[model samples]
Target: MGDTNIVGGIVKILETPEHKTFSANISVTKFRVQFPQFRNTSVVHLTFWGNLARYVADFYKINDYILIEGYISLRTKRISSKVISKSKKIEITVFKVYPLLLS
Candidate 1:
């Protein structure tokens, strides 16, 4: 468990939500959201699963502002083969989402 809640605009829907069936036909939907940092305008990544993923895919689009409640996770992935380099990324797993209506 982590303490992380984020409010930002949707920069890009990296991938549309899709349902995948695992062993025994257990299903889940997953998608990604990109937002910007408040202070420096840097980008952040978010992942939504199950119902939240479906909702986000149906209602959200690029450049839409939204408030998300979730936990942050630090992920490390191998990015290079020649040099054996790795990259660290921060991702948020969303539990709730709200569209920010602007007038």
Candidate 2:
């Protein structure tokens, strides 16, 4: 099991949550929450899965301040094909969430 981490920030962009079905008809809810950084205000994407995903999607809206508890992962993807460059994209999978400062 990976270590649990928590992050709190104002909701930058609250995209619509979606329901997806995998093999064997296993269903899961997925959503991305983009929050800003402290200094530069760069956005970070947080993923929510399962029941918590539904709750977050139903309750939270843009500009709402929320605290997220989850696991962090780095995804390496090719950023430029001509330049042969790769970049690490930071992703957080949220397991639990707390309402810090609702708006």
Candidate 3:
């Protein structure tokens, strides 16, 4: 399979705690970008896994702007009551975060 990659704006940040391990959530900002020929402003979500919690946390504030390049995916699991819930998640194994550059 070809490598999956996406470049978009960072929207929201979500953090969850499970016993000891932690997870991260980065919501995509609303903007239009060219994906070959299709342009879209739809918001995309990205999740940082494992030890990336701290790094992703410091990258964004309430309304900070950022650009993330990584893979896109979804995750589903059964909770305590055995209820299966789905989450829009991304591995985000490798990403480049860029802040504003003033010239």
Candidate 4:
């Protein structure tokens, strides 16, 4: 991966990994992480694909402090179903996961 970013934080949400077969089998996992910046909390959504997805689904849990190495991109999300408001969120396509501190 080029221009990869490394992020470290606590896992706030761990959604179940989705494993599906297309022409071939593929696995994807999504989760949220909360990191402290100054006095406030910042959150990021992480996407894990391939073999890492299976490893994460089996090993990681909430409150785990892990380092993510991947590419960062911004995405637009609807604030609410009834509202017209939209917000931009930072998302990372994780390539490698390091369980530096397990809780």
Best by TM-score: 4
Best by lDDT: 4
Clashing residue pairs in candidate 3 are: 11-27, 12-27
Expressed as tens digits, the lDDT of each residue in 1-103 for candidate 4 is 6564565443444344343434666877787776644333567788888888878888888777677777788777765554435667889888888886776
Error of 3 at 17 (Å): 11
RMSD of 4: 4.1
Per-residue lDDT of candidate 1, residues 1-103 (tens digit) = 9565554344444454555656854445555555654434444567776666666666766556677777777676544543334766667777777777422
| Candidate 2 residue-wise lDDT, 1-103, digit = tens | 8665555444554555565656865455555555555544455567776667667767777667777767777766554553334766667777778887766
For candidate 2, give the lDDT of residue 28.
56
**In model 1, which runs have C-alpha deviations exceeding 4 angstroms?**
1-41, 79-86
* Order by TM-score, highest first: 4, 2, 1, 3
Worst 10 residues of 3 by lDDT: 28-37
User: What TM-score would candidate 4 get against the native?
Assistant: 0.71
Model 2 / residue 48 / CA error / Å? 1.0
Q: Model 4, 93: alpha-carbon shift in Å?
A: 0.4
Clashes of 3: 2
Name the weakest run of 10 consecutive residues (lDDT summed) in model 1. Answer: 7-16
Alpha carbon deviation, residue 29, candidate 2 (Å): 5.1
Candidate lDDT values, in order: 0.59, 0.63, 0.41, 0.69
- Candidate 1 has a TM-score of 0.59
Which of candidates 3 and 4 reaches a greater TM-score? Answer: 4
